[model samples]
Target chain A: MRIRSTLTFVVAAVAALGIVTPAAHADSTPTVRELLDKCDNGTDSCVFHPSSRTEFGGARHQVGRNANNCSTVNQNESIAWSDTTGGSNSIGITITAEYKFGEEFSVAVSATYEHTWTWSHTVTRTDTLTTPPWSVGQIFHAPQMQRVTGTYELHFGKKFYGHYYWYVNNFSATGPEDTDDAVTFFTRAMTGDERNRCPKSVSTAKEFVSTESTPAQPALVASVRPGD
Target chain B: MRRTVATLIALVAGLAICTPATASAAPATHCTLRLETGVVTCGARLAAVTNNDVIIGRVFDDQNYGGSSFTITGSHPCKNGNGRDFGVQLAKYGWANRISSLQAWGNCWLNLYSGPNYNGDHDGEFKADTPYVGPLMDKRTQSIGFD
Candidate 1:
């Protein structure tokens, strides 16, 4: 009976002290700030190419020695960050449009990500396109420019744990014969210290040049029948 | 007994040598297109195809060249003589003038034509990762021959 009383007393004493064991720390994943540092420092693993263009069709003939130029510039920015959250991780993406080049205006952003656990896994992607308002005079005049900006916070599930990439498809303008150019600043999940280190613009300037030309008309040819 | 054993071994070895060896099969390259949504899926090792064969998908049947897509896998020069012509086979399966997109898997070039028998106006030359032949070639394609 005395031994039982002594054990009960010890249990009561421990409960009164509120002693609790702590959990093990989770693995460390690189933050958005760290990724920005790597990009600024020019690491081989995280390199940024400033300019890209996609020409849909070759230059063709137009009226009065005019030619069609169907090319658009694409600005891409990609950063890698780690996530220790067992659930979804959230990050903010901001696009500040500094200038514009041509007539029709639109902006598109695409985010691509992959899971590291599988082999030969295809990248999953999502895209959003927006067109700001423009006036008729701005569409016709030379050196037309506009400033636009946007911010978006994206939540990624735990399945997309390894690496993530965001692409800004800034189409400043489009026409039969036209030019589009713009400067966009991008920041995502940036902390106060990281914001100061991030570059103002993730891309460089691209220019489109065209010239007038004339071509001779094709001559008509008579068809030959099998029995003729 | 030793002589008999030696003869049996020799007979077994001869049989093994005489049997015809099976030819090594080529790895399959898969290209899947979701019709309703216009989504395309391609295999990972598309760049590893080293032959001159091109695979063209056609709708079961529809006259006015409505819905179709093509994928060319394997490494080959983008020229006439080097690549085999699958145009005849495609036309037989009701694929004439119905191509919608072209997917270049390997480092090869593809030429899209507007008429069958490789005649009429030429559309354009397409390379890797080009989603579709623009609006000009989208359902207006009558024939296609890869280089």
Candidate 2:
């Protein structure tokens, strides 16, 4: 009886001193989604930095419609993404064009394209409008462009059996769902006069991801043209 | 009478010791990141978690990301001989020859080798998440590349 009591006392003492450590098993690892929720609940193991606004001008790639004093003109524009890494990337940019001639000359393109290397999905928009026979040298204007917005997650790993931490990398911006408008040009029939004529405008917008966790990601850029 | 007393004592001591061990059998780390502020928090977490900065790839010691893990991160994606050349030498990081599954993100594809420095038996071009890297390649990864 005395020996048993001594052993029990020794065990309790060791337990109190915290000399015993439990074995760790990795069979029930937590999913990434679960961890994200923990962060949302304001756990300190995760470091979060709010995203800042990044506004960029979409370079305008213009398609010119020459005036035919004889009649109205019909125009059609088609766009698509021919190459990409697929839909893991959900962000897109919208393009539009407005003519300085009048608000009636305003063209809003709801067609949004993903930021990818090759363009595909032939989206064609057609419009027909009358032009004043005497009107020449008409210029179309491009209004303000849209901004990119979103958040990114950075998971940092340590050399432990089953341990990791993460940071919230955010990007915030407020702008129209659609971006830059297109402009049409008119030329008067005159000899040695190029003033009424505007060369084609090709605008390219490059999207970048800014995070304190990594270098600027320029690979997310896409180039668009009026007819291409 | 003596045997019964001894057995009772052993049972009581055994329960006292085994209780905490059972309670902490699984020491999984749980973490999360806030969308608005970009802050992260963790629960039932580890004492330390080092940031690798930019994440390009991740390796798991078990299938379906259910074990110890090592994250592969760099300034840029894995490139050929030049460019960013983001490659991880597992042995150098104390994870040599110990990988069973993996994933690639940040515009990257993965290439695995059984030996370090792009040597040994090779497999992959894994552009998608792979739950299992095959028996021949399981836990045989000595080097990794992010392309």
Give one digit per residue, the lDDT tens place, for model 2 in B3-118: 11111112122121111112335554323221112333344421122333344566666665434455544433233323223555555344677677765543456889998776
The numbered model that scores best in lDDT is 2
In model 1, what is the error at residue A15, expressed in angstroms? 65
Query: Can you tell me the DockQ of model 2?
Result: 0.01
- After superposing candidate 2, which stretches have Cα over 4 Å from the reference? A1-228, B1-52, B78-84
Best by DockQ: 2
Interface RMSD of each: 34.4, 23.6
Candidate 2 residue lDDT tens string, A48-84: 2111123344343333343333211221222221111
- lDDT, model 1, position B85: 23
Which candidate number maximizes TM-score? 2
